[model samples]
Target chain A: MIRKLCIIGVGLIGGSAARRARRFCEEIVGIDADPENLRRAETLGVIDQGCASLERGVAAADFVLIATPVGAIEPLFRALAPLWRPDCIYTDVGSTKGNVVEAALRVFGIVPPNFIPGHPIAGAERSGVEAADARLFEGKRVILTPLPESAPDALARVEAFWMHLGARVERMDVGHHDEVLAATSHLPHVLAFTLARMLGRKDEQAEIFRYAAGGFRDFTRIASSDPKMWLDICRANRGPLLELLGEYETALREVAGLVRSDDADGLYACFSEARAAREKFLKSTENNHA
Target chain B: MIRKLCIIGVGLIGGSAARRARRFCEEIVGIDADPENLRRAETLGVIDQGCASLERGVAAADFVLIATPVGAIEPLFRALAPLWRPDCIYTDVGSTKGNVVEAALRVFGIVPPNFIPGHPIAGAERSGVEAADARLFEGKRVILTPLPESAPDALARVEAFWMHLGARVERMDVGHHDEVLAATSHLPHVLAFTLARMLGRKDEQAEIFRYAAGGFRDFTRIASSDPKMWLDICRANRGPLLELLGEYETALREVAGLVRSDDADGLYACFSEARAAREKFLKSTENNHA
Candidate 1:
């Protein structure tokens, strides 16, 4: 029944969602704050129509997807709420759910029972619509955090929407989604960035980079992510992110102790166990479509 | 003047080195502990000839390269000492230089003037001769640690040998080499393995893996590395490895504090700084050519 979709902040996530949703719906419009982004999305045919301003573009769409940085989602939703059709559904493609959900609840006050929160767990080092592809979400897991008071019909429709785009959808409480993602996604990225920063602080940064082999390059590649965007993620998922970081540091210290003591056997055990676990994770995930 | 070369251990590194060294030398023979590996190298035409026995392989060769695991290098070098031609040059391809240097010196009262301790900074997650490619070393850095008493003539010959194989060789003291590599290569691998292990310890590893994005996959890809190989590396470089682990933990703890404090300003500063550093590192290393 949700045939027309308008996607806000048409960057990588928004553009990708628009492209993937094209197969399930007949129409898609994209809006972006940046004129260049709107122009690129239009040329790429990522959307049937594109607008530099959100208000002019998304006023009549059946569904509006807010896919911006963590800090911008609430403001975006509030701006679009006035134009939203009475029965039309609303959703998001944000990395942190709790903050965005709270922001939405604070701004919209339960008038729209059709609002659904979702996150498609798929992305690349690259960003923007220029880097977006329709197949980005195919075989990827998409987590939805619908409020308990959300209309069941609205949740089902949103779930069906993502499923049609080839994403396997799972629903969980928003708080739980924030905690799980904080551990698996946000914390790792923060650690990577921090490690890279420490190395770069040295006067011999050029030497360090020159000497970086495959391992160093891959380990810190995520460190090169967009600054403002990652800042937004860290701030939004602060509580759980801090908890996970403590756990990681504890494990690191334990390994460090074994190394300090010249406990070759202990170091070997830790490395072996870690390597085996990673192999198992990769093998188990191989069957996933994405 | 060095023409005939012999490489022990016909795995990825040995096979690739044989092919690359073949370009500079007229003939190269490879020896492997496993008959299957020797046979595969011969069948792949990676070597002019394959020797099932090391004694027969190094007896006639002017340059011998022990390209085995860190622990295996000492035993192989010791066994070859009896059969070693008086003026023959010897070298090794091990991850840890200090330990290998110590082992070699332990075997020979004085460090062999012709013994070159080297590690080529090139490899992939995949192993075995089948994965070897002739251009593997092209544009990659190769570090060499020559003892203070090492013969200049011997050092020159070894440097020329790797240069001919398309690596840009850099010289560093053994201790510094271990310290730098412990941070650039070893610690990152340890963290990767640990991350994977943490997930494996979880009750729903399958669920965790199902949602793993590209970030986790790439970050932990090296965790799929051979366990015995990593174990040897950890044991051999315990001192520097412990120091690097401590530094990494300290960095992680700082990020955790920012997260726990929910300080958006602090988080942004951290992310922005890291992002700039990573970009700078990448830009500087762009023209490394090795």
Candidate 2:
């Protein structure tokens, strides 16, 4: 029963929200700095109208989704703090929560009640509005890291909005959210990027990639994610990411030590343990997904 | 035509070869220490007959495929060397070639002229003969690393045999093959295992995994690979794998430094380079696959 929904960014994540919210919201307004993206979102019927400026587009909206990159969230929030209606419920879909919450604190001296920091655990290697899918959030988890000032009604509204888009809603404190994602998502991304860049810089890269099996392909699949966005994410979540990297390097060093010492038993144990752990995770994920 | 194709350790790789070669070879004889695997393979029609004894199964075969773990290749080759006719061509599909070739040289005091070391660059997370697929090698690359003493006809026969099974064939020296695979395959497996194990061992692992998205899933996909088989490959290719892991750690350290120093440009460069490289690889892979 929302009167108007304003989605900032209008790229894959934002456009997808617009697509899914089209049926529920009375009107969906898309805002983006890039005219082509806005035009594409409008043409694809992902939104009812496109706005070049956030202030103008969000003027009448009761629900606002800030689907910008993690770095842009703070600046956008600051810009809209005065303009946003008190009655409007605000949320975001940035991967990193700590930075977004800190940004709010820095800009406003206190977090806004209407602002609920969220991250939709959904995406693909593709980018832009052209890659938008209405069902992108279907069965996906949408995490919210709400501040102390966040009102219950606002939080409830945001949660309901995500759930209506077919997402499972989760709430966590900013620190815990950052730590959890640092190990599971951010660190994996770092490894994938490093592995891909290392191989790409090699003289025998083409030959190496040609010979790479499905395992290698899958192992580095996330390396193909949008670089600008990933770069923003890496920078925004640097602290937690650094800590996770330390853990990963420690684990890797242990593995190398086992290999160097020719500890076949140790290596076998490590591999078997990892295989078992991954198999269990995969099973759980499948069950949850089903 | 190979009158009788004797495959030692008839698991995924061997059973797959057997399944595809049934039309090309007059008989496919499977050998394994695990009687249950042999029984399953026989029941699955992946093999014509199960050979309990290596001495008897390969005794009269025209072509012998030693498809055991890389560690077992030497002893099997040694056992077969003394018993087989000089006319019988020998080859193996071990992941590590240097160890396999070195084993032959160590056992016979000379490289076997009939033996051509090869590795089919194809696999699944699942292992065993029951998981074998006839199309596993289709559109896949199979690398052959032949010794100086290897007969030209033996090499040609191995190439033709793989080609007939729908694989594109390439030839490289044992050192190069090991180095390439170490970088592209072994190192990735190590990272996947390390990340998965590290996350799995954490107290909050369930929560971490529950929130993990597709990127995390795909990045650690190979962590589910067969532990024993991967352990064997890791041990056999330890030299090259250790070197590659060192390179990977160095790259990771460099990335960490960029993050610690807040070098946004450096981080962007690293991520963008990786993204571009992976995109290029994905494009080429898709084109070739198409």
Candidate 3:
């Protein structure tokens, strides 16, 4: 059992981790720049104590979970470098892992053996500590990108911690994690944001949105996610995202050509293939949850 | 009250209309190309009678609702023209009004005064008679693009029919309806299909889909929609969809540049604006239901 667990940034992800860790840890501490969030986390029983100072929060904790947005990871790592504890298991729930690893290297000038980069593939459009749910990570996948310097014991402890919260644990290479996430998560967000922005900017924007059906609503639901967090992810994983975006644009052009030329066979083939792929995806995910 | 209602192409939309119209009509006759679908509709009580022959179906009907795919609307109209009833109030639930209008003009030499073109902005990824819901169009927007030749009584009757199914009816020009739907619905579907197709073709496709989270699932849910139906829509509304797609590509490039240049502020601005718009949209939709 973790003697003490400290979570940085008591937003949805951070507060959720703290809430779930309550059953596995002796005490939970939360640190946030916003006093309101810290208070809410403490009052909601998401944390045992709230701290404004990172050093104070991490003081005697045996586990530290950096659950801030991707942009804040580097600065937090820099601050934690001076208070680095080798006995503690450190992990993060950042969307992008390569950037987190780079931040660790840049901060300490050497990768910390206890620092394990992780990303919980779960979220909601809602934000803040009040939106945190103890069941947020239940049945979700938590990907850990461990570095060569990562201590085996620390990595195992982090994996066990996430499993305690009911998440399936998987290990992946940092670069591969970034690329896979760019395609699966980051790229989808970009497309959603772009579509919403484009349609929202039209002269007939109000009318357009009024007529939007259930499909449009579902297709653009990610556009309602936290912009700052998504922006950080976009910046951190620009390379893979741009590459995938280019490929997608090319595919769209081909489909457009099929539509323009009235190529029924080609259009049907493209759409059917996509539908088949999506059905397969849905079935696999359902089986996983089952 | 309508004495008899004839529904052509009794799939999800058609089946749903039949199910809801049961309360207002004395009898409902369903005509489908697929015998299995017709049998299912009959078994499910979505229709009172199932007819394989179009002539037999429309012979005694005072109301004819052509609920076929956009591609099939023209041929159906051609068949209906030879059996045209001046007393019958005819309408269709095709996706694209411009295409439907053109089809009517081509087949009947003029859009029959009783032929009102309509599109109900409500659907699910699931299709077919078995998936039809009686409440499918409840609280949904139905766009009616009535040509100048449309009889006022017929237009009013069509609007009343949709209202009876709990839909809000709005009249729009044929060209305007196509453009609005292209931005709100067609473009989003194309984006979803293209993204799914691109990622599904990847070498690490299995791994990519495995890592996809809820956002990705929701964002691409529409990709699982009926391929033939969507292909018909893409073909029928090619011009507006292509134009919007070009604009979308340019917007994506601008966002890509911001990401590549690490212009954090610009990226944040785009995402935040999109989020604001989406939130506003959610609020407006909620207010509409309220």
Candidate 4:
């Protein structure tokens, strides 16, 4: 059992983690740059106590889970390196794993044995502590990318920690995790944001928006997600994200070319192939769930 | 009340229209080239009687609503023109208004005064008559793009017909309707289809799809739409679709450059603008309904 847990950035991811881990941990302390979030987390009983300073927050923490934005991870890691507790296990819930892993190397001159990089593949557009729910991780996938120097027992403990919180835990190398997530999550988000901007800027914007049905609403739903957090993710996962974005942009340009030349057969083929692929993917996913 | 209404093409959109119009029409006759659709539509009670031939179907109808693929519209309109009934008002539920209007002119040397172009913006990823729901158009917007030759009385009757069936009826010119729909619907659908195909064809497709979560599912929901119908829409609305798709591709490329250059501020601006626009659009849409 965890004696004390420190969850930094007590927003959606952190607060939800605390709420779910509350059962296993004796005490969960929340920390954030924003005092409003800490107050709300306390009011919601998401944390046993709130701390404004990193020192006070980490004072009693036997396990540390840094849940801050991707850009803040390196700075937080740098600060925490000097305050390292040798017996404490360290993990994070950042979207991009490469940056966090690199931060550990930069701070310690070697990857810390206790530092485990984790990313929970679950979130809602409505964020912050008020939107926190204990059941957020229920049936969700949590990926842990452990360092080469990661202690076997510490890795096992983090894996068990997520599993106990009802997450379907999995492990991968840090680079692969970042690449996979860049393709699946980051690229799709950028496309949604671009499409929303396209229609939102028209002269007949009101009419266009008025006629946008369920399909449009669903397609652009992710365009309403937190921009600052998404921006940080894009910057943090630059390499894989740029590669994937270039590939997607090429695909879109080809489609636009087909439409431009009135190539009905070409357009049909692309759309048909896409429909088949989506069907195959969804079918396999549903079967896996079953 | 619509008396002896004849509806051609008993598919999802047509089938749903018939089901909803049942309460407002007397003796609704369903016609389709596919006998299986006719059978299922009959079993589902979406239509009163199934007619195999267009001659037999529109023989006793006071109103004729052509509900076929956009490519099939011209031929259907040509055939109906030769069998024209001056008193029986004619209309069609085609996705592209400009194409349907041009077809009407080509078939009869001029658009018939009885002919009206209408498009109900409601659909599901699932197609076929079996997926028909009476409430598909509940609180949905149905745009009418009537020709200059269209009789005022016929336009009024067509408007009343859809309005009676629980749709919020609106009017626009054929060109504007095509342009608006190209931006709001066709562009987004193409993006979803492209993204789905991109991820599905990747080597780590299984892993990528496994962690797609809510954003990816919602974004790609329209990728599951019937490909043939979507292809027809792309072909019919080529001009506006190509223009919008090109503009969107350019916008996407700019964002991709921002990510590649690690320009967090630029990426943040784009994402923030998109989020604000989506929020504004949804807010106004909800308020309009309220």
Off by over 4 Å in 2: A204-206, B203-206
How does each model score on TM-score?
Answer: 0.92, 0.98, 0.98, 0.98
DockQ (0 to 1) for model 2: 0.84
lDDT of each: 0.81, 0.87, 0.89, 0.87
lDDT per residue as tens, model 4, A53-146: 8998898688998899888987898888778887998889999999888888888888788878899999988889888889988888899998
Candidate 4 global TM-score:
0.98
> Can you tell me the DockQ of model 1?
0.64
Name every residue pair that clashes in candidate 1: none
Q: How close is candidate 2 to the true structure, as a TM-score?
A: 0.98
Which ten contiguous residues of candidate 2 chain B have the minimum total lDDT? B202-211
DockQ winner between candidates 1 and 3: 3
Clashing pairs in 4: none
Compose the digit string of candidate 1's lDDT tens values, residues B179-201.
87887788888888777777667
Can you write out model 2's per-residue Cα lDDT over A11-104, one digit (the tens) per residue? 9999998888888899999999799878888899889999887778999789999888877887787788779678898889999988988888
lDDT tens readout by residue for model 3, B231-269: 899999989988998899899888888888889999999
What shift in Å separates residue B206 of candidate 3 from its native position after superposition? Answer: 5.2
Model 3 in CAPRI terms: which quality?
high
Which numbered prediction scores highest in DockQ against the true structure?
Answer: 2
| lDDT at residue B119 of model 4 (Cα atoms) | 95
